[model samples]
Target chain A: MNETIQHLLNHRSIRKFKPHQLDQETIEILVRSAQAASTSSYQQAYAIVGVEEENLKQQLVEVASGQTYVADNSYFFVFCIDYHKHVLAAELASGSVDQTVETTEALIVGAVDAGLAAQNLVVAAESLGYGTVYIGSLRNDAAKVSELLELPSHVVPLFGVAVGIPDQQPGKKPRLPMDAVFHRNTYTDDDTMRQLLSQYEKETSSYYGERTDGRRTEGWVNQMAASMKDPKRTYLRHFLQEKHLSRD
Target chain B: MNETIQHLLNHRSIRKFKPHQLDQETIEILVRSAQAASTSSYQQAYAIVGVEEENLKQQLVEVASGQTYVADNSYFFVFCIDYHKHVLAAELASGSVDQTVETTEALIVGAVDAGLAAQNLVVAAESLGYGTVYIGSLRNDAAKVSELLELPSHVVPLFGVAVGIPDQQPGKKPRLPMDAVFHRNTYTDDDTMRQLLSQYEKETSSYYGERTDGRRTEGWVNQMAASMKDPKRTYLRHFLQEKHLSRD
Candidate 1:
């Protein structure tokens, strides 16, 4: 396999990092690489905020539901789905914000663009031998994160990435088997899903047992059932609405 | 400096592909690399449908608004934000579907996961000297696309990817200046955004003028203004609502 493919296939989320700071040049390269990612209609509907202030990082730790890595990583970046800039740019060209910015499709586009750029940034960091983990829990307290980052309307904090030199190497987590996650021509039916889950349960049960030294025995399904017992981040609907990202 | 970084920085979406088919092994590696992408909370909340049948590809081309590349590529994969499998697995574990499957945050997580996996797949393909482009236009007629693919509820089509051997090399698109998109400590204020837009407008105008042989002259802001005048893909709101993806 080629080096890039090998590097990509070896990806594992790292939550613990050593006390090493990334140089400015490295951060610049990573951000540039992120910008090189394709944007829908060249809208570039995203912006990144790099946080290094000790107090701010500490606050972010709480905002991210006590993910200590938020404060400990060499760098922490919050990727925002930014339509505010596009609004300003459009108004500068014309006299008002484009009507499109108010659509649900625009919201999805912004979020997807942010995801694309963030993944590229993650791969760039990994290629440099730096460890990275995405903090989706950043949404655990989205309003606070936005306030801490001085975000404007039409900009939502989608996720954060903590980048640093690795202090702990997490084992590669198991995914659904290839045939299970990938379908042919059409989506697999319920019968196929049931069969795939039965086999996957066995593999993941063994995987979790090995990783946790038997402290955790719940298979993937059981764990998902427990964690998702209730709806999560339901506030996001109102949050996006307040940001004027929902339907007009 | 590394090959991975260089390859990433050199990305350009290719719409034309040579008449070559990817062997099964290569497709496996690509999907494996995609699965390695970090998902939100191990939700694995995405699925890919590979399409090679001529009739299905032709339908997808129409669904994607006559994007010929959807049919011309060696392999086309539709990436969906899938919670259908999760619902089934959760039901198996707890004897009922979790309430979490119906929230906006859940939808966002699934889309982000799909985007993350798709980007990894693209990078992997690039490393192996292949070209790929994301078909966000897949959302233009998402309901039809889902019906064609037999997608179940809670499994929304996010986008498609057309992968193949490169038949044409498009010039790399320019992005916003680094300081413009990458903020430190907090997001930049309006003044900075205005200044950055001015400079970017000049650069992009020149880019468009050169590429189009001076036939078209809309700068980035003007183009955005024109495109956003009327909301495109307005049907998505109703589609998501019908699919039970939107909040009631």
Candidate 2:
């Protein structure tokens, strides 16, 4: 493998970080790298809010269900599906985008755009000897996050990334089997998918077992089944509508 | 900037590609790199379908509104938000994830997972000297594209990435100004946003004017207003509900 691919494969979410702050120059470079990702139809429908204030970070930690790393990082960035700029541009031209910006299609575009850019930022940070973790729990209270970030209508905070120098090393989580996730000309049939999942369950069960010294041995399927028993962030729909996004 | 950051900042979508097919080993490496990306809650809820058959590629090109590069590339991959494996696992465990898998939150999770993985694949491909472009036009005919791939329920194709050796050089598209897209501590207020956008409009107008030899001189705001005047892919909401995703 090449150096870049090797760097990617070595990725593990770091929850504990040293108290070393990232310089402004490094943050700008990371943001620039994020901007370089491809956008749907050149609609760069996303924004990054850098949360530096200690009080703001504490509020975010609470919103993230007490994930202390949300505050104890060199820097934190909240990625948002922001089309407020489009609204501004439309207003500048004396036009209206309400017919489009409120559609579900636009929401998907913003989400994908933000995701692509955030991944680039994470990869770039890793290359610069930093560690990062994506905080999807930010969506647990999306409205609170938006309020904290003072996001206007048409701008919904999707997730956050905390970047800092690593204070702890974590084992890489085992992913689904390649055959299961990568198909050929068409999707693999159900029988083949079941077989692959069965194989992965055994692999993951062993992984957790060894990692926890037999304290945890649940297989992948069981974990998924348990996790999916209840819906998460069910308020996201209302939040999106309140933000004037995906209302249709 | 570091080598990785420089590589990212130099990105430009290449629509034309040489007639060279990627070997299976190289494709495997790309897929592996994608799998290494972060997934929400370890729910690797996405899949990649590599389309190599000429007939299938032709159909996809049709779905993509005759983007011929969809078929002329070394490899084409459809990134899909897939929860089929979860369904299977739930079935095996005598549990149900219908409540969770059908929620809008799950759709966001899958979309973000797929986007993160796809960006990693693109970045890795570029590092290996391959040019790539994202074909979001696949959403123009989402149902047809799903049928073409024989994708099962609870799986939605988000977009496609076309990868190949570069056959043409293209200039990087100027993105929104950093101040416009990147806010400090909180979302920037409207006056500042407007000022930043005005600055960006001038930069982009000049960019398009110079690139087209003065044939096209529209600014960013004008383009956004025009694009957003009408909704694109209005069928996506119905499509997602039909696929048993985001039904809530």
Measured with DockQ on alpha carbons, how good is candidate 2?
A: 0.90
- Can you give the DockQ of every candidate in the order shown? 0.79, 0.90
TM-scores of the candidates in the order shown: 0.98, 0.99
Tens digits of per-residue lDDT, candidate 1, B126-223, equal: 99999999999989889988998999988889899999999997898789888878989888999889888888888889999999999977788787
The chain A TM-scores for the candidates, taken one by one, are: 0.97, 0.99
i-RMS for every candidate (Å) is 1.2, 0.7
- Output the lDDT of residue A216, model 2: 98
Indicate the worst ten consecutive residues by lDDT in candidate 2 chain B. B1-10
> How does chain A of candidate 2 score by TM-score against the true chain A?
0.99
Checking candidate 2 for backbone clashes, the offending pairs are none
| Highest lDDT scorer | 2
Error of 1 at B53 (Å): 0.8
iRMSD, model 1, in Å: 1.2
Residue-level lDDT tens digits of model 2 in A91-193: 9889989889999899999999999999999999999999999999999899888898899999999999999999998999898999999999999999999
> What lDDT tens digits, residue by residue, belong to model 1 across residues A84-161?
878888768865555687788887888889989999999999999999999999999888989998998888899999
